[model samples]
Target: MASSVLPTPLLKDELDIVIPTIRNLDFLEMWRPFFQPYHLIIIQDGDPSKKINVPEGFDYELYNRNDINRILGPKASCISFKDSACRCFGFMVSKKKYIYTIDDDCFVAKDPSGKEINALQQHIKNLLSPSTPYFFNTLYDPYAEGADFVRGYPFSLREGAPTAVSHGLWLNIPDYDAPTQLVKPMERNTRYVDAVLTIPKGTLFPMCGMNLAFDRELIGPAMYFGLMGDGQPIGRYDDMWAGWCTKVICDHLGLGVKTGLPYIWHSKASNPFVNLKKEYKGIFWQEDLIPFFQAVSLPKDCTTVQKCYIELSKQFKEKFGKVDDYFNKLGDAMVTWIEAWDELNPSAAAALPNGPAK
Candidate 1:
């Protein structure tokens, strides 16, 4: 990985941003501003021949399922289940020390005018220094107090509390916690932020792939384990799993994990109304919750990603009752299967083929 310093003068060469996209050409075009000065690796999982409109002077690389399957492995098989293959492509090709992964539907917000580039330059210096590897996650909601959703640090910092940035606040919803506070956004000049919370040494938390950055070295070998057979990719909670894996590796090595600082605006692509309708109609139930439950049952030494699965499972069960009681139960069952697999095969759990340990 090349040493990347934060850019001065707002030129494009300072950072490398990796985006995994499918057919959202307009969204891709809209995000062109964030792709400046950085190498863009667009993983087009569907048609290898499909043309994408890329910005001028941007160095871009395109990859298809065949390429992905070779890099990943059995996990790639999960991509076949989704229309757009999988979301694992971005991590597969990220070669920079500081990699920013954003969704196709989201774009980076531009820094406010009148702020000197020195602020951004200084921010970059802080980011590059060996302080703590901070992961930035965003909360997006138009109805929440202050700015839609909260970003950067958690709402209330309690020990062992799940340090997750809310994706959106579900207002007036019973049985769900409301996100009521907002942290001051880090200098908007940069896309990433240093987190405020802290964890034990070598610990890793599940990072939202939508927009997050950390030293490439800390990510370790879990990327290869996320692959699928047909070269597609896994979907749903893979990012959390990746985070768990990173945590396990770090914990084994005694690295501390922290959260807080720097928040970004995540533009929602799917219609909020339509999604709400689905949720109301029980169409969008979280089926993955089951597998997550099962994942937690694995050995105590299970990967960090597996632990996250368990944590999510507990959250789902505690929040939404039994899966059978709900409209969807398959999601829960899938997580259960993962737990069983890990328990039955401890060796497989310890090391993955093509994963980082090798």
Candidate 2:
């Protein structure tokens, strides 16, 4: 790690760095070069009695399990107790326009050039730059320096949609499913792809929350990580559930989602046997869940993020309730999530100033 470094300019103060963790955040030491300058919203999951400490000097607001129960009151039931899903609590409490969330185990990754990758800065650029979701750009990110739309690209769609989410990737330990992790314990991801592809509208992607950034204003309310972990039957799919819901909402609202680029060094892999127990149900459940998200069509009246999300919750109740009792509870949790979101972030700060053009 560098002795001292500068934070990403202009948006530094306006953006909040959200991290969800149960253990002491010694990982931030590696990120201090890029993150120390910003405000951190640390969502301390599990055992509030156990104090989680951050490195000295970084400005942060730490909310523990007890704090969450107190703050959201009845609505706190929507937040998962001993899971990363509780991280969304940081999202709810945040007043900033941009949110960059990374797991405590993820470290800074270096690009092929051997230079330390500034994942935070790249996410900022992704959020600020336009996303061409309507049409795939052959040359990848047309807005990236030295890149442009191919010859046959449509002029009408060139401006593209406002990117609501920037989904990043990981290097070293990959985010594989439990079965895969168990089978390939020795496998590691050394391939670093430089392109950032906009998830074309109407398509779904498995979103890993380990390293992610989103424009909170454009799609904040829809960014709930769903009800998983602790008392719930599901686990690990917290980010996946949020991604599916958010993607549908973003598509209906004419927003965009991009993935790849700004990779992080995933330093640790969770125990596969433990992960297997948590993921067993979701592995099968997602078979039905995928089609539901694919078929979802938000009504024209459901324009705002909250409206879209509430409407999505209704769909969850109507469609998945019959699938299992857990779906029904998840549906209820979804509604509660919206209620808590609205109650906490009362005034919608939707208008966020864009970063300078590339």
Candidate 3:
């Protein structure tokens, strides 16, 4: 077992890790060695009949759905059955400077130097590095061939101006669109890549739920993964939609999306058949949704990104009224989430140059 691999001592107190899982806690023991300095929040997703058993002396909280609902209140119901939605629960309760969402099956990849490197530490280093105005960049993978952009990266922004959102990529089992799996899936032990990309300004890329982290300061607006996956009406696309919403709002706020670096080895592989089924609706809807999001017109008075997000959802409902009832609930949930976040982080809300519209 290795100790903390944080590049800076300060990160010890600044980062918290969240893992949402339907599986038991046995796999978590592997993480105990490096987690001493950070807090871990384990969200038990399904069949919470048995309690998750965390190793003794670990600073952690194991919460089942009921516990999360209690913390999130009535609006929690809006989140529904999506596992990705659990991230909102983690984000709201996170007390650190940064919050990391790592799937239970994901692990930090070791560097060529044979030293264990923590992905969260690497990402923070990249994120905090002095950049002009704002950061919207992709971390490039050193091991990958050619110019392989992260899937769902917005082509429109490839040449657009620079702007403060960053998204990382995964190795081993890559997180690609379902169509990529039609041929074959990556082997469990596929070689991973390294390197961080500071995506050029004006780039809009989707954020991955697994192995992703963001600053708590932006929590009020970007900390949402809506109703799209984990057995909800839609089988997949929860994080993708959230990413799109985040990018849309980020663009309005002059923020950039950075990808690459802090890579993780995805131990679990999606069954291609299951993935194809899960992604069918999402793949079909995303083409139209992107342009729709681009065309959405926020109110002139819309100040905060959260307000813009609510407006975006409302617009989505109007245009796609017959899409699905859950879509409307997603809008309702975002409204509820923004209100709850404002109440909880009044200081952060006040600090926002454009506070939520009253």
Candidate 3 regions with alpha-carbon error over 4 angstroms: 1-8, 131-164, 186-194, 200-202, 229-231, 297-300, 354-358
Better of 2 and 3 by TM-score: 2
Among the numbered candidates, top lDDT falls to 2
Model 3 clash tally, residue pairs: 22
User: TM-score ranking from best to worst?
Assistant: 2, 3, 1
Better of 1 and 2 by TM-score: 2
Q: Best to worst by lDDT, what's the order?
A: 2, 3, 1
TM-score of 3: 0.80
Lowest lDDT block of 10, candidate 3: 130-139
lDDT string for model 3 (280-313, tens) is 8777787887878767666756667666777887
Clash count in backbone of candidate 2: 0
Q: Which one wins on TM-score?
A: 2
Candidate 1, residues 110-188: lDDT per residue as tens digits? 3345221222232233344332223322432212234332354543321122211211111111111111111222212
Clashes of 1: 36
lDDT of 2 by residue, 1-358 (tens): 7768643475976899999999999999989888888999999887888988889989999999889989989888888988998889999999999999999999999999899998999999999998997899999999999999999999999998899999999999999999999889999999998899899988999999999999998888888898888878889999999999988888887888999999999999999999999999999999999999999887777768777778888988998798889988888988898888878776772423222111
